[model samples]
Target: MAPPVEPDALPSPFAGLPGALWLYRFDAAGRAHVLDATQCGIDAVHAPDHWHWLHLDLSDARSAQVAAKLPLPDDARATLLSPDSHVNLQLDEDEAVHGAFVDWAHQRGVDLAVEGQLRGDDGIGWLHFALTPDLLVTARRQALRSVEAARRAVGAGTRADSPVRMLELIAGRFADTVERSGDGLSVRLDRIEDRVLADSIGEERRDLAQLRHQTVRLHRPLTAMRRVLKQFEQRHPAYPEHELLPAVARLNQRFDDLDGDVATLQERARLLQDEVAAKLAERTNRHLYVLSMVTALLLPPSLVAGLFGMNLPGLPFAHSTHGLAFALLLGVASSVVVYLALRRMGVSRST
Candidate 1:
């Protein structure tokens, strides 16, 4: 009997983050016995390559790092180990990683897309179509649970035996990411709503800015993926000796759903941004009203003092002790009148 394999040696990458691999045995009815890649199996590691197998992760650094460990054919050796493979070749200190990934994909005939979003404190990911006739690869930098789930499904051999299945697996991943993003956003928005209405929460301007940045980053990949998905929908490539129409149709539905979810999130984010702006405006107006009321209140007292301080012998309230009390009363009465006027006008100017 073969010796037992260690967990680290598993064929599926990112083993700890809930990943799995599935291989399907074919029969007349379609896929027969499905083999889980994580389990010890006759066709696990060192097994021959089969069409439509999927391996992906939301935390790209770990999975991509491990994929580099996969043994490459001699012909592909030079390309596999090159620095370009580790860090996207097209990038420099000034360029973005996603931009470089796109350029590389275009050069290699691999269709790819990515979407990233930040709503409040939550991060969202939606990546699609990083596979080609030769290989399929997708990555999201953050920790996403759905990527792990899809990897588990594929490891368990639930996917079909065609490139289209690989596409579906990827599209399904984006759908999962979209759903998760929505859930997270909903939770955060709920918190913000509570704080906005209940507690005197400080401005969320910085939070809004962070969210905008995350959404923009996510939009880059999603927009790119949308293009690639459209290509799959229209061109309908043939590979792995199987029909891909069903898979492609399913992919279309998934893509539509993902797009809709992203749109909703963007709209929600904008609405929040607008609310923040309105609140800020209201705050500014309130402050101005308070300042104006204070100036009005001070005006009467300052005028009375100025009149009595005139060193002229005949100044009206200068010599009399009664005059000082009368002037004090005048100032007090003037402040009361201003305060009442402001109150009637709905100004919160009182300290």
Candidate 2:
């Protein structure tokens, strides 16, 4: 398990404002400046070309109260405050883009990911945001690694000309996270494939099944996200001098490539699972065939012994001491004949 995010992990720009984590303002020239939370007031005034970005911590009790103050459409506000964890995006009637994006959680005290391994749920986080022409608002209940990456990019002097562009930057970081995870999953599948091909799979069927499920987990959401983006493109056809068109295309391309990789992994894992099942079935059939042969060879001896030990009035065997030897000899002879017959019938089989 990972430790929860510390309150001080994100520098609080609005000291007196509950739920406000960090705020930024960009001038017409696209220079980003850290701002106080007071600037987010509904009645606050700013220059015509000035835009603001306000990030809130939804874990705080007053986050909904703070979100209510933003001058945004009702749906956009609802999206920002939505608790749904699935990957989603919507271009509303008012043209406000809002969605929840999947991301890697930022762990403070421990590192759950060891080299090429992913620890599943320990690494998943969702970043929710709303974007319009000017203002961009992002909120999260847990700390997201994309937030740190975005902060670093801004600190390194990457200029976001618009709120949509900033959203792109954060989303690109998330895509990178997905790509990295896909690579890890690929590595794991490679090892699993090797094991499946080189060993008896009767024992490994469980692990192979789990790998297929994990691959599907990644594949499903990516497919859904791709569908969402395609819907966006259908609604707003691209033309010349459009920032969003190109941005959406680029984002979609990244996700599409990721989805392709995950899909391939999914197919490969499934094939390996099938191969494992085939091998296991073959083994089971071989064991059953051996058992049947043993049973056939023992059947004649069992019948001979049953007759010799019968409590009937046939006095021929009860009168002579040599009768015991004769009965044992008969049992051995019958067993030998049955063995010879079985050998002639052969153990050859079609796989």
Among all windows of ten consecutive residues in candidate 2, which has the lowest summed lDDT? Answer: 110-119
Report the lDDT tens digits of candidate 2 across residue range 136-158.
88999998877767866775688
Candidate lDDT values, in order = 0.49, 0.76
lDDT of model 1 at position 243: 36
TM-score of each: 0.55, 0.78
Error of 1 at 34 (Å): 13
What tens digits encode model 1's per-residue C-alpha lDDT throughout 246-314?
A: 654665576566667666666776787788778778878878877787788898788877777778888
* TM-score leader: 2
Candidate 1 lDDT trough over 10 residues, lowest sum: 96-105
Off by over 4 Å in 1: 1-151, 156-159, 194-203, 236-242, 332-351
Instruction: Give the Å shift of residue 82 in candidate 2.
Output: 4.0
Root-mean-square deviation of every model: 11.4, 8.2
Instruction: Give me the candidate number with maximum lDDT.
Output: 2
